[model samples]
Target: MCRCIRLQALIGLLFLIFMVPEFKAKAQVETIASQRQLFVDDFLVDQLERAELEMHRPVDEGIAFNLDKLWEGKFSLYTTIIKDGGTYRAYYRGLPDVKEGNDRELTCYAESKDGINWYKPNLGIHEINGSKDNNVILVDNQLTHNFSPFLDTNPNAKKSERYKALAGKKVTGLYALTSADGIHWVKMQEEPVLKEGNLDSQNVSFWSSSENKYLVYFRTVDSGFRSVSRASSTDFNSWDQGVEMKYGPTPLEHLYTQQTSPYFRAPQVYLAIGGRFMPNKQVVSDEQAAIMGIDPNYYKACSDAFLMSSRGGNNYNRYFMESFIRPGIGLNNWVSRTNYPALNIVQTGDTEMSIYVNHDYAQTTAHLRRYSMRLDGFASLSAGYAGGEMLTKPFVFDGSALELNYSTSAAGEIFIELLDEKGNKIPGFSKEECQPIIGNELERTVYWNKNTDVSKLIGKPVRMKIYLKDADIYSFRFY
Candidate 1:
């Protein structure tokens, strides 16, 4: 079998062959309801009928902000943006050159009201180049090498420690910093909180609403490849020993920065936009690099952004190996570390979300570029004009109705058939009775001739067989 088939089979390996009885013989046996899934990474999907994991490309929205300030430079990497209350804030490393310590690699800050128009204010936290009128947050310390921060979502979190961050490198380990208003900061402890795990990249941590613990994904070496590891903590101070992240049996590649974080809408699901690095994979010629105005050292390697996801564990499912946000139609983006994604994704419009990328890295034209995608439209089970079908694994749900986030061509349509636990099509819920779905919508209810209500199947083991023609089913949920 091909590697894709092997990887797909390993997805639900733990639950397979669990001696499930026939639906007619053991009907209405389920008691508790199963949790809803976003289908973000195919972690819950069991089978496919002709449909496959269709990768979605993010549309380029142009540069949202540029590092034109006096203090900012080409090496402003690991940038993080968060929607804090009514205001949006961005933080990143500000390194004018490949230097370390003494205001060389300082943590800088920026603010945006609508998350698009950004302004770097004079916070004056650090005195750089004989001036204090800059957006430097932390300076003269090695902690700014990759200072990563996030808002504390714990309900019982103290107001004084509303903002938390993790930083440091291989030798000194990771240091914890906290702030009440995200401006003034203090170290939680003098010593490192996590020392053994690698901290070379953006070692991100967040409060998992489902697990009720703080989870962190950091850099690591797995089978001699640049991989990731994960751990959890009850509090930010102490953490459990983590294990290397497993990407099923899929071939592991160099992930320069695993910018993993909890999706705001689905806290239980963690989304990662990692930089797939190709060391020594130089493509830009010396003349091409000069024409694009990129640094000479920046042309030694190449990289692009790839998507990954997890449900809070040591495993990250890479359902799609293709570039999530490709370096498109330009020579500047082909340079080293140019297409690396920032730390977080935020909702920029009513129906759109944006992810920032560091473009033209190590070049005079360095800037933070923007990419947008439809909400919950990362990957889809898509079918073409010839039409195809898909069957989900046997599971239970809680909501009274079924909703789909799908888009279809004018001549396209979608039909769903509800099946019992034994894979038998339930009467009145077959494709013949289901109304053909047409049009583009983010949320549309699926209906049948017997009525759209699915309250009867709320707590029972059921499945869905979806037929599609020239359409894309981005996601589905019981709620």
Candidate 2:
């Protein structure tokens, strides 16, 4: 068997064995309703339906190759998909333009209303490097940074104070970017927030359920291998250096790569990572090392992706590809042999997720492609249900309403409720559950159509207590 097949099979088995529970709740099982606990019927709802990627281009025709500029003279290495106010913003790395060399790397900006059709922001926003036109934020090569924008309503909340962004050269040092709004950031003075500790910080994120910080899968320089690194932080600036999570593809193996980004609506704490293959070792080198040396007949390479979870950020589980139907490249060769994920994956609505990426072939500029999908069986499960555990760690809130996502497998009746911090259902909302379109996937949205007064619960600390015995939860968003 090919090494790719073997690696994939191993990952699949690992996820099924440890995380997902093959539960047999009998058809006639009694509904167990408790005071602190509530029950929804066992209805299967396709919350997230993986959709085929659609391409968007800044240029008129053909692919727009290259990353968005987060800094001047820099390429966008990692991106955080964010919806600022009404407009959608893809805040990404403005990695140094290699054609210009390291000394000139900087951060830049881009904006879009629809996730597609991005426009480079001409806000005339100034940068750290005294650049006014290039849209460059920082132009210094001594400290390279990327991926630090996070969404938080309460600017003064200390618990929500972790300033995050990837910095350093190949040695990505974790740093902090502080902003009153999601835009207009100021790099924290006491930076190197996460120093060159034991683990290399590649990409960073936090789970809402646990209200904690996390670092994405990484490769150790020593082994030249990649894997997930786990850590905890109250403030984004500092981290409790963590353990390396083991699962799925590794960089050392032939083209095996995995990554993490936010999931749309299932649970606020949900995160997805994927695995892909890197056939040639030289891709990591300065030049196109493998392309210049490797024989074409040797490797059948394709990018593979996966998913993982963390409540408070300190702990994590390795994800696996558990589909009975094997995954293969379906369309466009734009993503072929690519190094960075095009655009950041977005949580469109509850359970609806689409990872936006761009690729430039020998065509025009570059086109953007969205990889969308929904996970069924998420509702019947709780936070980390695969592990038979919910984020029961008493979510301490800054008075943010918990955004809930619900979907059904077969067309059936479903009811939901708002539970106070004390776990009692609030009054005046829809008492009877409402049914949305059955089976089809619903994106990052709640059944707000049913409950007209969703506002009453907005400013309070509450959880969108979903009572679908048979519904699937794609994700939840907590303020």
lDDT of 2 by residue, 250-357 (tens): 223321333454443333333444334344432223233244332233223434333444432434433223311123342223123332343234544454444554
Badly placed stretches (over 4 Å) of model 2 are 1-76, 95-101, 126-131, 142-145, 153-166, 170-172, 197-201, 211-224, 248-264, 281-304, 310-319, 322-339, 342-344, 347-352, 361-367, 374-479
lDDT to native, each model = 0.82, 0.41
Writing each residue's lDDT as its tens digit, candidate 1 over 112-213 gives 998888888898777888988988888746588888899999998899999998888887888888999897788998998998766788888888888899
Best by TM-score: 1
lDDT of model 1 at residue 111? 93
Whole-model alpha-carbon lDDT for candidate 2: 0.41
**TM-score for candidate 2, residues paired by index:** 0.53
In model 2, the Cα lDDT at residue 66 comes to 39
Candidate 1's C-alpha runs over 4 A off are 1-36, 98-103, 290-296
The lDDT of model 1 is: 0.82
- Model 1 reaches what TM-score against the true structure? 0.90
